[model samples]
Target: MAGAPEASPGESRLRRVPPAEVEAARMEAVRRYDILDTPPDGAFDRVAAMAARLFDVPVASVTIVDADRIWFKAIHGLEGVAQIGRDPGLCGSAILRDDALVIPDTRTDPTARTNPLVTGPLGVRFYAAAPIITADGHRLGTVNILDTKPRLITEADTENLADLAAVVLDAMELRLSGLRLLREEQERRKAEEEARTRAERDTEAITAFATTLQRTLLPPALPPVPGLELACHYQTDSPRDVGGDFYDVFSLGGQRWAFFLGDVCGKGAEAAAVTSLTRYTLRAAAQHHDDPTEVLDALNSALLLDPSMGSRYCTCVFGTLRPAPGGGFSVTVAMGGHPPAFHIQHGDDGAMVVNGVRPRGGMLVGALENAQFASRTFHLAPGHGLLLYTDGLTEARLPDGTMLGEEGVAAFLTTRTTPDAGRLIEDTIALITDLPTGPGDDVALLALSVPLAPATEQTAALSTARTLATPVAGAARADQER
Candidate 1:
């Protein structure tokens, strides 16, 4: 306590200390802010610097009054000191008042004359402070400005100091709020990342299970049919969900093979289950009956008996192929609300064309107990073949909003010469692949053709001409049929 003035015989105190309860509550409020003893902050330091410049004071500080000390949170102009005893500083008396305290000449005032800072070697003669009050009516500390020479402060000076103290309180509240918001935002981001990771893992597991089930529903490889060359392809719309399209070729006994292609109503696990039931049922039913129509009738009955089907149905094309008497094949086809098959014929001139053959008036099977199905018979001679496909082909949309309907398919077929089943299928797949948009449904294609003669026997004919000539009689027959 330097520069303290000697006490006179009769002198009154400048300010009264708060009651014990009030002082205890005031101290609790200061501790609740959690700001004391912390490191220097730029925000509070800036306020102290601005206060010094505005008042033209040699020293300015933001100080908090504790039980036994006045501690500086921010200081300007003073060096080598951070705190002092409660009894020696002007800020201690300022904390007991609700308004600013101004001592123009501390040495002349009886209450401040005995203060050590004024009478000691430090020589602080003028001091002004505004109380930093809490929201609950407790004064915690002050924003103080001090000078060595005595000087008077105007009313405007007192108001400016009050405003500066308000700025200090605002900075403290904002800092606390900002820290709380930052912690909440970090927690939200962590939760979202964990949810995303879990979803990805679930999708991978479902896709693997669907792929394994799909493989079991189809034939491993087409059983080689004597006197016929076969090629089939299937395409799925998405790898994440199983599609409803299915096709199989299996043997019934000697010289007879059963083949079927179908599409169920929806997608995913339910449609996959239906597809499996249809495929196995057809294989077993064909053995009990020789007629294609009777086999489809049995399928209709089985679907109607099952309650789990739940108003769902499917469209199918079922057929049996057998060797003809002479040198070709005869196919009996039954239809159940399915697309027609294309019979591709080669002209004598080697130009290839397509002819669609459909069974008349077939009903949607599995939807009704007494649904009707129809059958048709066709002969595949040498240099002839047949192609069966799902509606996903003809229903595909081009960029120009035009559909590749039945006529479009016929035009596609007429572009090729010599009906080779594998080549025809490859060209059809390329057409769909080249479109700007993908087909929204599943596509399945099955082509069966009669093989050409051995290369040795046709070597002389091949040498004579690379292109086959169109005969007058065969051309006339094709025109009459058209």
Candidate 2:
């Protein structure tokens, strides 16, 4: 093999060893590969083995040149040795050259004759190495072949050695890229899992707060009233949100008690705030004013005074129940743009009659500066009941686009055979729940009834009073303009 051309003394002055700064940069680039001192890889082993067979050399190695040492990444025909000193080897000098370094008969070559690797026990006579250059022009290592005996080599052999060096560099780059991608994928999955865990914890906290707040907005239990049986039920369309509909049966002291059911315009925290204010205001006003109409007027004024209640309004039925002389109760109900109250009466002949008691001219409360409400007085005898509810029941839509309107609800009540307050509420709930397309809005029901006793002489008079005091359906409209 013919050795690489040597530089003359004058040319050698221009070809000094790389400066300290340049060598530091080259070493840094080598470290970036992270392949130094690593275990043997099959890909590199194959390349070294191929170079030895192709060139018919006794030894072939894929060597990385560090600052002071030459490390063998892959070696063939070399046993139990992984590295050698850079001062005694050809690979270090090969990395400094831009082209392949070839030397035949090291005993005669001036550069090779001084190398310990050539003059020592394992006498190396012929040597060929290709520099492994990085993309940025840093030569970090070499793929070299050596023979103990001098031999002749063709130009094609030198070219083939350079090609094998390229293969080794490509394998290193491919491995580093795959490792980077895998690390990135693992980091992405870890971030996603953390986000999901945070969301679950947040949802749980919100649900607990909503439930506790909803309980405060409604009555814990209906207040017990003398001679009157009361039952109520409330349901929401979604568990995630707090419903705006509210109902309460609270005592105003003595035999007299106040009850009201209403629905705010929207749902959620804002509506919930309004609901809390409404329930507190109604109870406070009812305690001072015994009249239901006056109580509603107080609410309208409070809502109007608070400008924060922007564009928010509610439909309500506020009522006061008091025991009437002779064995029954008299209820004065005031309506504020709410649905009609259902009255179920049992006749002397045992036939049940259902009537809707609605006071017209009632406008939405809290909507205008001067909204009017309607009030009506009715007598409830034994076996007679009154039902008040929010519009969620009547406005429930069926699959056919038809609503369970006032008529539909009245029909449902008529089919029941004289149910008490509790049974009446349960049956209505069953009807609302059984709809094929479930109720889209929240439902609230309040039922008040008098217990039935055996037929007595006072029964006839009580029955007559209830019939004569029955509130005419649009009676309030006459006073609406006032």
Candidate 3:
């Protein structure tokens, strides 16, 4: 710290205020900002860096005045006194100037050279001080530059001081914005954690009941289709983390069993709202249009009525598993923003699964007024098993936060294929279950297998199954009628 040149006898270049008045005004302005005695931050440190470079001074600082001391939020080439005695600070001198105060030579000036700062511990000789003003024009303090040797600061250095002060204000504003977002995120997490804790402590009572209700919302049991052995297994990452992940199997008026697996975008109640709406609507619309594409189209049309629902969308695979009139099963599936289904066929040694058709999701739900989906047809060979899963299974993160990607799913089916759904569900959650705090999403999978029947039972099964089929009375909403 050093004293600045005093006004000459005849003409004063720097704006001057009474020492007492300046000190009092400084205290009020600094307190108004409420940035006193705070921790160091990137925003404040950056001002010191810029000042050092722009002024070519060894020491640059943003100093604030409290009751009797000057505190430095940012300091360069200066240490020990985050706070200093208020008596003879170069910065205190700067606060008196509405503009900057530049002193080229301190030794020749009687007022500056005689001051203790010039001859005492600091040994400062050259100095520049620029007032730090609030938006309302109150000078809080100063951002000053200092050097040990006597030298002049250029006109450019003087001009940049005001500009650098403005930058300090902008930096402060940015820091406030970051703080606001951090608070919002923290509050949201706290609310969620409290709800989760409450739910976990009472699992068997309310938790079990909620799980039962969620289960009942699915089809009561897999539809008794003619030749298809269908069973679905769904397990969430955590019990209380219940979400809108569903697998359903229902009849489509004839030999067809319409099955689907879908997951709503978010977790908790909002997701469940959209999920419930989609499930019932798809079921109800099946009466009119049993095609997978048609059901999704109807769901899309329903969701678009909500404008704030850009956050709402579902990834679903909707398809029909029918005992073909002549042979195995004829499957026609359409996807809507969902992952593709994998089919495992019988090989000589064991069963092998491959993605015969790519992961396809037609139009993103709620994207526009009208979005379309196209359906694809394929044949399921004898003893083939079909698996449809949500991204929760594929993107499941491990303890290290790595995702269980397609490669991991591929390895699971290489040597282990059985009564499909149960094994699949067990393996999927094996890595995910232990994560109490994690990237938890819902897992919904449907497994449909058609085992080869003995010669005697084969002939009678298809005919008897057709006899069990209920006829469609109406076209519209007919698919949902069942």
Give the winner by lDDT: 2
Q: What residue pairs are clashing in model 3? A: 283-480, 286-479, 287-477, 287-478, 287-479, 287-480, 288-477, 288-478, 337-361, 340-359
Estimate, for each residue in 1-482, the C-alpha lDDT of model 2 and write its tens digit: 11223432544322347788889999998999889899987657767876887788889999998878889999999899887777645776687777787777888887778676776788888888999988898888999899999987888777778877876776677556445545655665666578987666655654554555566567665654656667776767665567889888777777687889999999976687567667766876786688888899877875664455677789899988878887677888899989899999876676767888878878888998788888989888778888888888898887687999999898888888874776787688778768887676877788877877532222111100000112112110000000
Q: Show model 2 residue runs off by greater than 4 Å.
A: 1-198, 454-482
Please give the distance, in angstroms, between residue 301's alpha carbon in candidate 1 and its true position after superposition: 0.9
Q: Comparing 2 and 3 by TM-score, which wins?
A: 2
RMSD (CA, Å), each prediction:
36.1, 35.1, 23.3
TM-score per candidate, chains pooled: 0.53, 0.53, 0.49
Better of 1 and 2 by lDDT: 2
Instruction: Give one digit per residue, the lDDT tens place, for model 3 in 1-482.
Output: 43444666644545565667665665676665567888875445656765786567788888776666678888977777678776666666666667787777667766578767678777778777777777766677677777888897667667677766765654454344335535655665666677986444444443443454455445545545556555454555555444777777777776766777888887654565566667766775665676778888877766664455566887777887776655568998888877777777656766665554553448765565677787898887556667777787778766677786777666766656553433544444444455544334566656666555522332211111000012112111100111
Local error of candidate 2 at 171, Å?
70
User: How close to the true structure is residue 20 of candidate 3, measured as C-alpha lDDT?
Assistant: 74
lDDT of 2 at 4: 26
